[model samples]
Structure formats: structure tokens, C-alpha cells
Target: MQLLEYISFLLLSSVKFFFFYPVFITKEDYNFLEAMTFGLTAGFIGSSTFIFFGDVMYQFFHRLALKKAITHPPKEKKQRSIKHRRLIVKLRDDYGLWGIAFLAPILITIPLACILATRFYHNKGKILGHFMIAIAFWSALIYIFKSSLIHLIS
Candidate 1:
């Protein structure tokens, strides 16, 4: 049950965001292997699903936005969107997909990363593959370090 909870949490939270949960669970359950397994599996599955879904939703919303713009031209200021677009453009210009892939697992939530990646990159599979690799690497490193720290403390 605890393992289920941990995986479910990882599914919703970013791999980095909930990376320490496994440590806590290990402390309580003394099941480092199980916790690590759940965490890693959850990170992979959750991030993959999120990335794919984000791509689909982005396409849908993009089409919807175009249609809306064509039919009902808005007069409202898109300050927030403009700001976000600028930020994304800056990130794209500065770092590109590799940077986003490397940083996403640790620096940002998976869904947000997926959305950004999808917006910038045309290859969904490639982006998702990079995200999975990042997640796996981070999950393993975090689990090892945290579990070892817990062991040392105990």
C-alpha cells in the first residue's frame, strides 16, 4: 500500500519534486529496494504519459486557439502569454532540446517540461525518450544518495 502511494505520488509530482519520498518511505519501511523501484517506475510511466498527453492537448488547444482567433479576434492584452512566449524563446535560443531534457527531470515538473519540449521540438518520441533517460538517471542517483544518507544517519 505504501509503495502504491509512493508511485501514485510520483505519477502526479515531478520526479525531482518527489525524489525524497522514497527516502522517507525507506526510513519507515526499511525497504529501500522496493521504494526505489516504485519511484523509478512511477517516474518513467508518469513522465511518459504526461509528455504524450501534453503533446495531444497542445495540438488540440493550438487548433482551438487558431479557430477562435479566426472567428473571435480578441482585443484583450496577452501580456502573460507574451511573457511566457519570450521566456520559451529565450530558453530555446540559449539551450535547445538537450538543455531542456537534461534540466527537466531535476529543474522542472515533467508536464511543464513536456509542454515546453513539445512546443519547441517536432519529434515527440525523441523528446519523450530524452525525458525518460533523464528521469531514470535522476531517480537512480537520488535514490542511491538519499538511501545512503539515511543509512549513514541511522
Candidate 2:
């Protein structure tokens, strides 16, 4: 029964809501090491899968974008374009990949974060390392809040 619960926890962690689900799984009592292992492993797997194959996904999206562009020509830009671009640049400059990595596992979900990181940042190794750190960090944090999370659930 416990093994089945562990497997279920792993699958649930991989899909989304990586943090809270483990607490949900072990609602009555928390097993710190077990939750950490399963959650971290699932996060790593998701991050690896997306980051490694990002190129293919990128190309696919790029081609689709090109097709859309060719089919429908773009309209004239609004005067606010420059300000918007500046804001984006400023945010990117200030936060960049690390911010995305730190928030990814807990907030944005792993696959989207990995894709965004790979799209903007050129370093696969660094991205993966950041993801590993983020997963570990969030996993530990979630486990630390096991009692509260379980209480909220039940």
C-alpha cells in the first residue's frame, strides 16, 4: 500500500503542482525523505525532458509562427511598444534566468520554465543545474510545511 502511494505520488508530482501534492498524498503523516525523493526526482525528470528536447519544440513553434506570419501580415505597432519593450528588457536584465529558475518548480511548472529558460538563455547545463537547485529548494520547503499543508487539505 505504501509503495502504491509512493508511485502515485511520483506520477502526481510529475504532472503539476509539484509542491502541494506530496503533502496531499501523505495527508495523515509526512515522510520527509520519501516526499523529497519522489518530488525532486519527478521535477528533475520533467526539467530534463523539456530542456533537452527544447530545440525540437522551439523549431516546431518557430515554424508555426512563420506560417502564421506569412498567412497574416502584422499590423502597425502602437506607440506604447517602446515602453513595453523597455519594461521587458528591464525585467529580463534584472531577473533573467535565475529568477525564472527559482520560481519555476513552485509557481510556473517545470516544463514551461525550462522552455522559457532554453528559449532565452543559451546554456543548457546552467539551466539544468538551476532547475535541480530549484526543485530541491521547493521540495524541502514544501516538506517543511507538511503539517500545515496536510491540515489545509483535510
Candidate 3:
């Protein structure tokens, strides 16, 4: 029964890791490391999926919506200034994959990354690789901080 309970906890943690971080961590039963792992994994997977297949998924949904004749309210168009374009180009040239992976999750979303990858380079593998690297860096930072906090408290 204890083993069953542990398995149930792990499963729940994994699912929570894939969807929401704060929700998983708020569970009183989960220890620090368990919660961190769940949060990191969830963030990684969510970010990766957004970076790799976001555009395709968006298109699929868009097509479905069109078929269903569901009208999306039109969005206001924001003009991109020359400076903004220059900044984007600089980021693309300087950071390449790593820049996009790191900044996208912070500034945009994985889906936006996917759109950028497809629209700019048309390379899904490269986008995924960059996103995973970014995830690794972010996860490591989170893990270290969490461990330090636990150590300090204990």
C-alpha cells in the first residue's frame, strides 16, 4: 500500500510537472526536490512543445476554427519600429538558438518560438535543441536555489 501510494504520488507529480508548476508545488505532501523536479519537467516539456510544434498546432486549430466557421475577433496590429526589427535581428545573429530558447520563454512563449523558427529558419530540430538547452539552464538554476533554501531551513 505504501508502494502504491508512492507510485500514485509520482504519477501525479509528473502530470503536474507537464502542466503547472505552482499548482504542483503547493501540494503539502510533496517535498522540495520532488516539487522542483515536477516543476522543471513541466516547464521543459511545455516550453519544448511550444518551440517545436507550436506553429503546426496553431495552424491545425486555425483550420479547425475556419471549418467550424468560428470567427476570431480581429487583433489590433502593432507596428514594428525599425529599432525593434534591429533588436530582433541582433538577437537572432548573436544568440542564435540559445538566445531564442532562453528569451522566448521569458519574453514570449514556446508557440511563438515555433512560429519564429518556422517563419525564419524552417528548422524544427534546431529550435527543439535550443529550447532544451535553455530548459536545462533554467532548471539547474531552479534546482540549486530550491536545494539551498531547503538546506538553509533544515
Candidate 4:
């Protein structure tokens, strides 16, 4: 029952973000190796699913939109808010796809980052590699700091 709980927690966490796994596993009394493995697995599975399947969803929606356009015709493009436009432009111009990939696992949800990466880059391998590096780095950092902190407090 405890193992099942831990597995379910990690699976859900991977779909959410990589940042919380170290803290979560430590709290659950898992060792460093178990924490690292579970954290990485969660991140990899979530991101990989989005990277491959997300594009298929995107195309399906895009084609749907195209078909709708043919039947209904198009309207004037809606004016996007300046803030929204600026943020998109900034991400594209300054950060680009790599920046999103590097920050996605930590800052945003794994699936979101994967979707953004899929949208920008056609090379799934490159995005996956970068995500793996980011996940490893974050998982180690979280585990080390969180474990040390726990010891200090206890």
C-alpha cells in the first residue's frame, strides 16, 4: 500500500513539475537513489508523451480550424493584449526554444514545456536531451538541499 502510494504520487508529480519530487520523496522516507530514479522517470514520461502526442493533437486542432475556415470564412484577427504579445515575442526572441526547455521542468509544468518545445522544434531528440539534463540537475539539487534541511530541522 505504501509503495503504491509512493508510485502514484511520483507519477502525478511527474505530470505536474520536476521541482517538487525531491521534497516529496524525502518526506516519504525514500533514499537518494530511489528519489532520483522516481523523479527522473516522472519527468521523462510526462515530457516524452507531450513531445510525441502533443503534435498530433495540435495538427488535429489545426486541421479542424482550417476546415471551419473554409465553411465559415475568417474574421479579422483578434487583437491580442500587449502583455501577451510581448511575452510571446520576448520568449521567441530572447529565450527561444532552448530557454523554454531548460526552464520548463522547473518553472512550468512538464507537459506544458513539452508542448511548447514541440511547437518550436521539430527535433524531438534535442528537446528530450535538454529536458533530461534539466531534470537530473533539479532532482539532485532538490534532494541534496531538502535532505540537508530536513536533517538540520530534525
lDDT of each: 0.70, 0.76, 0.59, 0.78
For model 4, residues 1-27, the per-residue Cα lDDT tens digits are: 988877777778777665457557867
For residue 123, give model 4's deviation from the true position in Å.
0.5
Off by over 4 Å in 1: 1-7, 13-36, 59-83
Tell me the spans in candidate 3 whose CA falls farther than 4 Å from its real position: 1-23, 26-40, 57-83, 150-154
In model 4, pairs of residues that clash are none
- Residue 122 displacement (Å), model 3: 2.6
lDDT of 2: 0.76
Candidate 1: residue pairs that collide: none
Per-residue alpha-carbon lDDT of candidate 3 for residues 3-100, written as tens digits (9 for 90 to 100): 67545544443233323343334444356566656545655556556556667787898798787665665365346766777887787899876777
- By TM-score: ranked, best first: 4, 2, 1, 3
Give per-residue CA lDDT, model 2, range 1-154, as digits (tens).
9778766766666657465555554673547776677667887778888899978888999999899889997787677988966864564589988788887777777777788788788889999998888888887777777657667888
Off by over 4 Å in 4: 18-20, 60-82
Q: Residue 72 in model 1: shift from native, Å?
A: 10
Candidate 1 has an lDDT of: 0.70
Q: How far is candidate 3 from the true structure (C-alpha RMSD, Å)?
A: 6.0
lDDT minimum window of 10 residues, candidate 1: 14-23
